[model samples]
Target: MTSAYPNGDSARDSQDVSQPKQSLFPDAIAIPPEVLARHRALVLDPATAARTKRGNRPISTVYRADSMLIPLREVQSLVPRPGQVSRSEINNELAKIGLQLRPRPEQEVIDGAPPELGVSVPLVRLEDAPADRAPDPWTALVALRDAFGDRVKHFGLDHLVLSASVAVEGAPVSHGGMVGGTPVSHGGSVGGGTVALHTGSRNPVALLMPQPPRPAKVPAGRRPVVAVLDTGIGPHPWWSKHRPGDPIIEVSQEFQDLLAAQEGQQQNPTELGPLNHPEDVPNEIQPLLGLIDSHAGHGTFVAGLVHQMCPAAKILSLRVLHTDGFSTEGSLLLALHWLAKRVESGDPDEMVDIVSLSLGFYPETTDPEKVLQVKAAIERLTSLGVLVVAAAGNDATTRPFMPAAFGHGTGSAASGVELLSGVGARNAPGHTTAAFSNWGEWISRWAPGDALVSTVPVWDGAALGGIRYPDGGGLGPWMRSAPDPDDLRSGFAVWAGTSFATPVVSGLLAQALAEDTTAKTDMVGRAKRALIATDAELARRYWQ
Candidate 1:
């Protein structure tokens, strides 16, 4: 899609006056093409069950399993109540296509949704099913929809969701060997003797400056919170330097409980474990190899952006994506549903004023029903007064990316809060779209995303690149040379993508809430007012 604004002074002047200037920073050292290629091949390989689709250009790569997620209520709607008739009928219908219901989790596990909202059953294809049947969950769902037709629609079967794929929205590697209409370059270099890595054609240079967190404007108990749903935040000095009882980042007790309960469930890989320590290395895909996964430190980087924007806001660091940059729609649904309920409880301590989603997917189809469960979960959060800021995606295509696209138009009254913000990536001055950023009407706002420096996990990956004076650290403190492209030991990186931009918008909204001393005291009232007012202020300045 063509950019929304043409280049030149007119474009710069068109930017909202209320928005701050987006400054450019030195880019991070680029990962070697072979390293990026290896990572992408592992994550997006069709043999791995991950799928990629082509549009005007290649979009995002979505990783999926063979299972389908069927909302229990929707399935129940297909059959009479158990008391009225035996419950065997539903199972019988599932058996027609060789699908079988997976075991259910404890009600407390999926708490926040209605008690009757039984665990979403993962219906697996029978190993012995006919060979001619649809091979994947989406195809099977389509077949079922076709067969059931109006019956499915009448029963609100929209929730028969795909256990679809969702990836971190950052530009990590090219999908289908293409990004922004060009093939990824196999080589690149930067000054300082460091080998600069290029993601697709976007250069990410190495930088050493970590954005320091400013003091909170609000007191500990009253600070607004922004929940970052992405690869978990790893160890970083920004949070470690804070005094006890006051932290810039934290995982809530409730979120901890959810993770603990979900652990070992096998239904979904939670990536659940301790965080904020050196031992808690962020590279999950190939730790032994010591190579940084394409998405390692993604959450930490995003959290740091928010920290710089609103230090007074407590960051709820939720780890939903694996270090490899992939997660399932089901896992996201669980987190979102749980969050909606957490907000519904009206506990000020647990209140999340903004949800920064730097991840999303392009659904196989645009039919609203295809995204029903995910959209419902998001709508539930917004209705409760939390503003969701999602990335418009990094593929530079106009294809609608989920959750973010929900922000398009005025939004539904059911959303309860102001509309969700679909954020696109703008270049340094933050005026025009980044070449790698997805655009089109669904994008509601744009922020500086190209080569912005922020905190990353202080990791020395296994990959061997860049030269050093001493072969094995024999020089100890003296040995130094070029930046290792994959090494994040500096705790800072110059990365680009809509992933980072979403947090800029989230942090700004949180800043507005934190600075609003005269706003209503109630959580919902304050957040709603802040969201509407901040959104309008943004619209006045950013939307062209």
Candidate 2:
């Protein structure tokens, strides 16, 4: 069991004296020349360059991080504990070594301190900093590292990044971890009651995923299902028709099959499901949709969005979060693997056109651990022609969030959290990055996260099975009157964070697949580009 961990820190007793300092943190991966070229081009656009006033050279963008890169913030201190001088202080001391915090548009003031001492501020890049220079950022970081010593126990890529381990505080920050507020989607209190600013409750999708107009005939006859894998779903009015026999309804019996194969399979190949189409429709409500985890109503809420956007589309729900709000290990991988099988059936007519995951974590987790799990799942599904959309995370770090960011790997590090494709948030009217959403290396696009709206389940804890009220199980579940569509009401709320961003993208993608199943080629890249292009278009307004 200990060996299951990729870093192998669980069995620290069986020692190898040789490998100590070499790989203390994740090593920086070298970027290929081609990708770097594209990244440079994007950051140095003429209009973008116009934003810079610092280096004399016009530079627009600050940092270009990996899709899964999570930025680590260093602790700021002038007088290093008994042993060292702060890097900011050190920079101020050296007339030649002026500390440049933010550069491009404006240079930060050093406060006339010493060169040996340093202040840990927000990590800066060329676009957002005072000066862009080779080797200096690394140099400033090293000065901090030398002063901090083993207190830098945080783990991540080093040389390229200022190793997350060495900071004074030892906790690894959650890139998309800080999100959620209030409860609109489920049986509260019982299922790990949600709270604002603490990464809790009723989280979901992105907004306005641009799609080409489709013909009206397809949706007129048949509707497809958009699967959302999140914490759990509440028993809202949307799922009033849910039944007992089909407690765990899915598109087919292939759910278990997908889970089993993923446990040990390494390299992902084709994962399409077996044919199980019965020409005659069953009498019961087709178990076209499913809800998992007695406690996690998140799955319920995420799937509900699909229902709202594409009224005709069916839903295949998978519960990955436990009744206690904890999403178990291996569950996410199973969900992705399951989704791949359903999409790669060869017969395009029966495939699930869109798959949605509204979870986020650091990018490294996306590699051999989760990335292979998802990418393999995606390659197979998309090849068979399915679209997968995820949240950009609500951590709102300076860099882009994970899963959705390009080239990120997957693997759970210290916390048992699995990072998935993430969604960035946006504000109303402005649609800029929502204040609550987390950011990472690849900050591609942004949509609404703060004060967004969505649907949740309406059921007593016991009726929903084992779940209870948010205040903890002293009383029986609260039964509010079901939402009546005819009676107008306010469904939108002022919640914020990363989980909020994913559903919008998922809903939009589902709309596209439900409307035009034929446009599945290169859909993943196209969707990514569309998101960025849309944000870029919105950005034009600010510049003008």
Candidate 3:
């Protein structure tokens, strides 16, 4: 077994130190009282609590695994320290169960103060037994707790985190049947009398559209850069034309692996013969435009919004979320670390003016250590003058969402973070908040996210999953289709969620930073001030 202590000290040896006594569950920790009460209740009746929690949620959404972060001291007290417990031993002890343990990296110290817990053990799910054996998750958790008692510091679902956006809505409206030998859709109007071509098709065999002109240029070195941490960017024409050079600076290998795994799972044996090559098919007909999954194009859409709002701002695409739009807390933390590294690199161009995070997680417990880690990461980034923006979530509940809710406190770093809530489009204004958007005082800003039209991976034939179109029937319109004329830019789609709202705020902030010369060095403070001004202005215009 590997030593739990960084100094190579065994768990027992580390416990014999003459230092001051420390409680595994410390008073300074910030686990919400309600969370603790619920945990206690759960431990008392695992089966009932588990069943109740899983009753309404679809099985697809419910995570079958429970991940626990155990402190080293607590582990030392266990009958068999987690590090000392082998896979076979655990499986044998708890029938039809599996456990895998890995040591967590040391927690970051804040303000020159060391963290309460020096080392943590991450207990992850390896696999599950047959359903007839017993209900999973709860059964597995109960068995581990029975064996380890209080040694299990914090237990929660290894939630499958995803973008806070809801499904796409409304059918795209097309203009005259053809314009200059091309099928074009009239997208209302942009500046003055100019009609926006929402959708355009060239040859009947080749559904090509004309690309929009390049955005107006800004003064060199004056453009604010926004880093998008989401799914990977694209091979779309718009992105390809705008970002001629290397656009995506970083792509997470873990996310790529997950994407490949999803693609492998999505492979249809009937559609493609046993030996058919995927590359032979046209790009437009492929699902997700041959990307990993439906949500793989999410980052591109978000970047498009930012570009549309702040044409002068540069974009840095950092792929963190998997193709399915899911990522774990550890993955997020690593991404933040990467961001911090880039900012500290001393290259002015690499320094991100703002970070747009459209993703979040809802942990069953508010484990103080985990919360503090996230807070520390945010503080580290903000302290370096990078503004962070996040979605308020689509849960449609008052339950607080992290990173977003972290933006709300009195802490110095909190001011640098902004939380965006979702609102209906200006044309379809009725409800102050979108029905699916999470709301409360924690949300710092609101932006139009309902029925938002943005870029999507180009595809033809039918949208993935053969989802129904808003026109009351038939297959959904593809953002990109086969025989696509290379003359036009990529496709677009109408989606809704607080996820999109976050990027709106991010783009607005980037625009503010680009236009204000004096605010460049202190963009965080500038962004907060701008947010306050906008809030007041919005209230005066709408609330009045």
Name the weakest run of 10 consecutive residues (lDDT summed) in model 3. Answer: 272-281
**Each model's lDDT:** 0.57, 0.36, 0.48
Give Cα distance to truth, residue 124, candidate 1, Å: 3.1
Residue 483, model 3, lDDT: 32
For candidate 2, what is the TM-score? 0.43
Compared with the true structure, model 1 gives a TM-score of: 0.73
RMSD of each: 8.5, 22.6, 16.1
lDDT of 2 by residue, 1-544 (tens): 1122222222444555333232222223323333233222112232322221222322122122211111122223322346564444433432233343421111122222222111222233333334554323333433433545443323121111111100001111111222244342421122233532322232233334332222334542445556766543444444444344322224344553433332213222221121122111111111232221222334554554555555545566655533322222234544655565545544544456566656533433233333332344445555544555656554324333334553232222232121223345555443244444444333333444455455544422211323324333445366343332111122211233445555655555555554444444564554444334433433453310
Ranked by TM-score, the better of candidates 1 and 3 is 1
Per-residue lDDT tens digits for candidate 1, residues 297-355, read 77888888898878777888777765556555656776787677777887766677788
Index of the highest-TM-score prediction: 1
Best by lDDT: 1
Query: Over the full model, what C-alpha lDDT does candidate 2 score relative to the true structure?
Result: 0.36
Give the alpha carbon lDDT tens digit for every residue of 223-276 in model 3. Answer: 678888876566555656555553423334543343233222222431211111
